[model samples]
Target: MTDWWLWMYVAAMAGGVALFTRWRADPRGVPLSEYRVAIAIPFWSGLWYLVMALGGGRAEVAGHTVYWARYADWVVTAPLLLVALMLTGTHSLPGRRWRLMTALVGANVVMILSGLVADLTTDGTARYTLYAIGVLALLVVYGLVWGPLRAHARRQPAGIAAVYTEAALLLSVLWAGYPVFWILGPSGVGLLGSTTTSVLLVGLSILSKVGWSIVDLGRLRALSDRGHLTVV
Candidate 1:
């Protein structure tokens, strides 16, 4: 990735920040947990994107064309994304502690980082082993989302429940595609060429990160309008 191709990633990341900037706070000063988490989601994500945008995309690891900058971006932003999901439920599921949210966030980070490690591993056996571990972690992630999280959302108001359910679904589907991007790249399965991988990964990142942020923003605004969200 060089020149315009490389700059494309920068543009995508920077544009993501721009999209989320509009919602960094409740313009109306409503004090909702969703507003807080919603604001934070993009701020950290945009920060990581900026970091990745500045850093090196290529690394000399296993000749896999490692984009460690992307890994760095995920390591930090992934947890914030999970926490954003939990915040959607703050008012609906008020009695819960952060244990579940924290655990889920940790699991999510482990899942992606492990996959990155696997992709970077030169040894085939070790790579597959790490990949399996990452897959297991993702299963656990979905189990939590569809299990307790889904249950709680169901008990929320109809609007909140709808938003949470759709948000969870969007998040789960998009996040799951990361490994596929890994596989398509020169890194993992080598199903695609380097340029192709970069393009697809860029598109995927935009949809997952920017798309995820937008879904939550619309949801939060809806809650605010319905008087379900609290005032900040």
Candidate 2:
């Protein structure tokens, strides 16, 4: 397949990085930590997509070309995205929040790594087994977001609570589709070709990364303008 999709993803990610960075310049009452992760998601995605477009970070796995760079990007960006969502909910919470954030990050990392190994495996049994593990880890992630994280958001003021709710729900919904794409794409049953998979994956990535962040940060900005957000 042609690499034009990869190049297009690179441009999309680059635009995301620029847009988020510009939003970060006047963060108002929002914390720099939020902006830091927001900027990072697209920054890393763009960088890795650039590498993939230039014909780097690919390898033959199970007789199919695997873009390992894509996994590398996910392993980093996924956790950052999760953390950004966490920070939105827990930023104003009292006491040590790092423990929960750490747990979420760890589970997310396991999920990404499991998927990577599954992609690399040539054996059907091993591949599906790893995919199952990844799915388990993913369930844990959703549990935390919809469970404790949602509770935390509810404790916030109405506006902040609304922002967190929207962000978390949007992210969780987008994430639920990744496993389906994985199962159908080259890494699994090959029900979808690499070209179609790449298109869908890129669409998902843009929505989860750039689109989600804009919805999130924009709401936070509105809250800040209204003097409702903490000076975090």
Candidate 3:
């Protein structure tokens, strides 16, 4: 069952690469930067899932088997995902976005790093403390995305704004599940068994990475077709 979910993740990512490549071949008006960042998300994710599937990327942390590679995957891909969303939101306006982008990326990194440390810590107090910190970091990420980022995106043309809304909503909701799963899974309170946790995480990864990219790119392509795409 674990192999099934692991390979499923690999296959989903491979499919994302192919789908994006086909769309990128003739990008119409979508920026190459977007395509590159979009492609990198799934590419990195697929590689890490491949690593996990090959019987590596696991560590015995706090008496639980932690897939550290998943955190490694998040450290890389999560930033890239935010970058993609940042590009989408600021497709026409880039000048004032760097600050928000920095906050988003910084908070995201802290979230992933803290989660990793929490996983590795054996002390219950330390582990939960780090988990709280990670949760706070995630809240910061959410505030940036929904507050400042969404506000900026709304200033875009209607098409671009709509795309940003859909993409941002999709990403935000999917990401909220990660911490819940973490706290419930073997890593936290062990309310969820490892197998169930792995399956759930695999499902979330597929949506947040592969599924979200497809929606983002597809909507952007539509905007391009409608002459809403700007060279940013």
Candidate 4:
């Protein structure tokens, strides 16, 4: 009956489709681990949102009807996403040390957690402080991706490199939007209505979680079809 319900419907469908496509399709040549982790984010995210959607929708925290479920989804899915990137990166850059990948994953979780704290906190100064920390941690994640991950992707074949590069860029842009929406809030910027904001937030989750998952996995499937994938 509401926009959020529709948004969740689309997200749930998209996430389910992504996983089904992954499970049903033959690997061709894509690394088994890459396929698994790439599919994992949306799989978990879909379940998270499905449960939230069924459980009376938006949640309240400190008098604000915040989308805490989305943040909780990010807590698990964000790190899983980075792991997929790292696994995909290994196709060309074989020496993708586990430590750097793990560090990025850890930093992303911290970024999400700090932002959650910022959102939950009632104190303006403390909120801003947490937001700043989250932003800094997020920047570190970008630095890791662009600096090391980019280098690794570049070393990969032209096609795999392209896919990895686009994935990295797509993730950076999409993931960055979360904080912008969080900062805007219901009383924020005055650019969007509360209902509209909720719609856009759900829309964003669908895009980042469902859309990205399907598209990136599609790329892998394409690579596999072309026999470009390595048996990692």
Name the candidate that leads on TM-score: 3
Native-to-model Cα distance after best TM-score fit, residue 134 in candidate 2, in Å: 0.4
- The TM-scores of all predictions, comma-separated, are 0.85, 0.96, 0.96, 0.87
In the range 187-228, model 1's lDDT, one tens digit per residue, is 677888776877777777777766786787677676777777
Q: What is the Å distance of residue 156 in model 1 from its true position?
A: 1.3
TM-score for candidate 2, please give it. 0.96
Per-residue lDDT of 1-232 in model 3, one digit per residue for the tens?
A: 9978999999999998888888889898998888888888889999999999999999987678999999989999999999999889888885756778889999999999999999999999999999999999999998999999999999888899999999999999999999999999998999999999999999999999988998999999988888878777
**Ranking under lDDT, best-scoring first?**
3, 2, 4, 1
* Candidate 3 CA-lDDT value: 0.91
- Judged by lDDT, which candidate is best? 3
Q: What is candidate 2's CA lDDT for residue 82?
A: 84
lDDT of 2 by residue, 41-160 (tens): 999999998998899988998778888898999999999998889888976777657777888999999999999999899999999999999999999999988888889888888888
RMSD of 1: 2.7
TM-score of 1: 0.85
TM-score winner, 2 or 3: 3
- Give me the runs in candidate 1 sitting further than 4 Å from their true place: 1-6, 25-57, 228-232
Model 2 misplaced regions, further than 4 Å: none
Q: After TM-score superposition, what is the CA distance of residue 16 in candidate 1 from its true location, in Å? A: 3.7
